[model samples]
Target: MSRALLARNGRRALPLIYGGRRGTDTLSGVHLAARRFIVDMSYSAHFMDFKGSSIASSMKKLVVTKLSPNFREAVSTQTVAVPTPGDADLLVRNRFVGINASDINYSAGRYDPSVKPPFDAGFEGIGEVVGLGLSASSRYTVGDTVAYFGSGAFAEYTVVPAKEAVPVPAVKPEFLTLLVSGATAYIALKRLGDLAKGETVLVTAAAGGTGQFAVQFAKQAGCHVIGTCSTNEKAGFLKSIGCDRPINYTAEDLAKTLKKEYPQGIDVVYESVGGSVLELAVNSLANKGRLIVIGFISGYQSASGIPPFKGGTLPVKLLQKSASIRGFFLPHFLGDYREAMSSMIQMFAKGQLVCEVDFGDLAEEGKFVGLDAVFRAVDYMYAGRNLGKVVVEVAPPSVSNSKL
Candidate 1:
């Protein structure tokens, strides 16, 4: 059945169409209709008897309360009106929102504080397009599942550029977590790392959000994958996610372990965790190896006000081996947005990617704690307690029915 038909039944939905010039049509109009249907369906049956268009239209969002040096006082929540989509945007009914260390960094004022505070915080998530603007394209219908990029996924609804949302294959909702973390890993591996088949790839913080995806992506690219985690438990988890060798950073020396495992050194290193691990990773690089600096989660909460890396070491390593280090932020790749998104979607469709998530023990029931829980999750992430992508379920009832 077409998404439009399914949408008529008031089922949650995502985008249905794909690439083309941007414009609107009857199909695009279905988004508004579907949203109306959902709003109508959600009301009490008594309100259903009323024939007026009085839809309750507020959304709850995780907001930054104050820019603090510590994790506490960094995050909070507020209710706001759901935003309308722009001509090139889609208003998504967010389901599962992925939490990353960067979100915490922004909350703690690591970035420019001039951006202001009490704003929504989130990087990426999966959702259904409930509405679009008049000039919106037909690349998606109201009910198709999609992965999107936007700042407000920490809320019940978010607006993403239509071009920035990717139509997901018919996979379980849990896999959307993979789409969130896995796609980032895939883009970093393919675009930044320039991963080649049979090459050896190493990922620091390999058991964390982006690292888990890096391990699986590198393995799918036919690379011998090695991962660094803080504990044996996490190391085992990394192996389950396709890392051929898992180095327990707490138990072993990374440089010695890498030298013992691959004496020739690694072709690419996905450096998401900086600090000593990053230092060890650079030393383990092979001739012409690429080190992709994706994040510096290790230094996220440093109270000493230290720089992420002592400047001399990176340059010294680069000069010694003639290796290169490249930094990547997914948003900057928006120029080739279509191609990057297509590559991820195809890999997902082919089952070449695996996504792991730490759904919080509290998530077992439909009940969720609060934004405080989000802070705890982020803390656990920095403390190296989470096994995979740590996602805080916003509006649990909305996502309770989501598939894995």
Candidate 2:
């Protein structure tokens, strides 16, 4: 029998014939090609159990139809042939996929201009290894639960490089937070915050996903943790998570409160909000302070991509106080990924860390479930209606159950 291998990433189609020779080509960091089996017919044996059939042949996935601020309008679902993993890859049946504030930006072509429309969406996912290529079998076995960070995660299944997949203990959604949100906080604070005991660390949007981790990490570093949020409910949530001070910016002006309460100024600022809030963080820096900019969420849904900087300090104030602002883009800090993720996983398992996830299962306006719920989840996050990491359930327990 013959199987047709669909082309992806501009590569030509490569057909796989039973007991035939193999070929290979690489695209988007994954190898797509035919695999040669020692038993000649082991191909069906490797993939037949994916859905209790001889590989259903097709899968449903999300794709970016165009760039738009409206995430609901930017993406569309399509039924496509399941991708065959090359020797270095594992075909994963995605269970849950994590949502990020930057998803809208990616859809708007802000992350990579070279990428055109009709590209895959999503960055982090947790799944079970359903199929493995020859080389991947050495490191990963079918049914191994793994969490991966890459594009094309907004799908029922994702083909991830075995080297890039983190061997997880289970198919739980908490691990998804560690892959991206936890890593962002752990690495940024450890490397750039230069945190010290008794110092004051302020995390804006502290009730949100990555911000919550930043708050906890700062507290763990023996620093006095201060968190900023929009409402009293978020303030209470921050306090419950070890935040020494939870500033409700809406109840009182942020600048005035900082001047009154923290007259010495904030020692370190984990600034995510842009526009006026960013300016306030910059102006409130203490002597030798450092502000780590993980993202400008305020501008993510805007047309300009990034809000115009209006810091009064500019270069003169920073020079005088010896304060600095450092930007953190996770991809640039790949070296620290393993260490950061390992520590986060251990801490979470031991109950030393909390992984808050808003599965979008309970929404006042509407409930979210299944792949179709991604749009509502994105809208919920942008509306600041979510208190923690947002995620969408791609497949239920029946389909995502791992042998482990």
RMSD of each: 7.5, 6.9
Model 1 Cα shift for residue 115 (angstroms): 1.3
* Model 2, span 94-175: residue lDDT tens: 8899999988889998888999999998999997777776667655556667899999999888899888998777888898
Clashing pairs in 2: none
The lDDT, on a scale of 0 to 1, for candidate 2 is: 0.80
Each candidate structure's TM-score, on Cα atoms with residue i matched to residue i, is 0.76, 0.87
Cα miss at 250, model 1 (Å)?
Answer: 2.5
Number of the top-ranking candidate, with TM-score as the measure? 2
Would you list the C-alpha lDDT of every candidate in the order shown?
0.65, 0.80
Top candidate, metric lDDT? 2
**Location of the lowest summed lDDT over 10 successive residues in candidate 2:** 23-32
Instruction: Output the TM-score of candidate 2.
Output: 0.87
Per-residue lDDT for 1-404 in model 1, tens only? 22222231244434332333332222111122222222222211111100121213687777877876465676666778876666567767666677777776777666665777777777777756666543443454454456766676777678888766766643244555654466567677777888889899988888887788788878878899988888888888887778899988689877777888799888899987777777777888998999998877767777542336665767777888889989887766656455555555555556666656686663434223443466666666666777777876654433223221
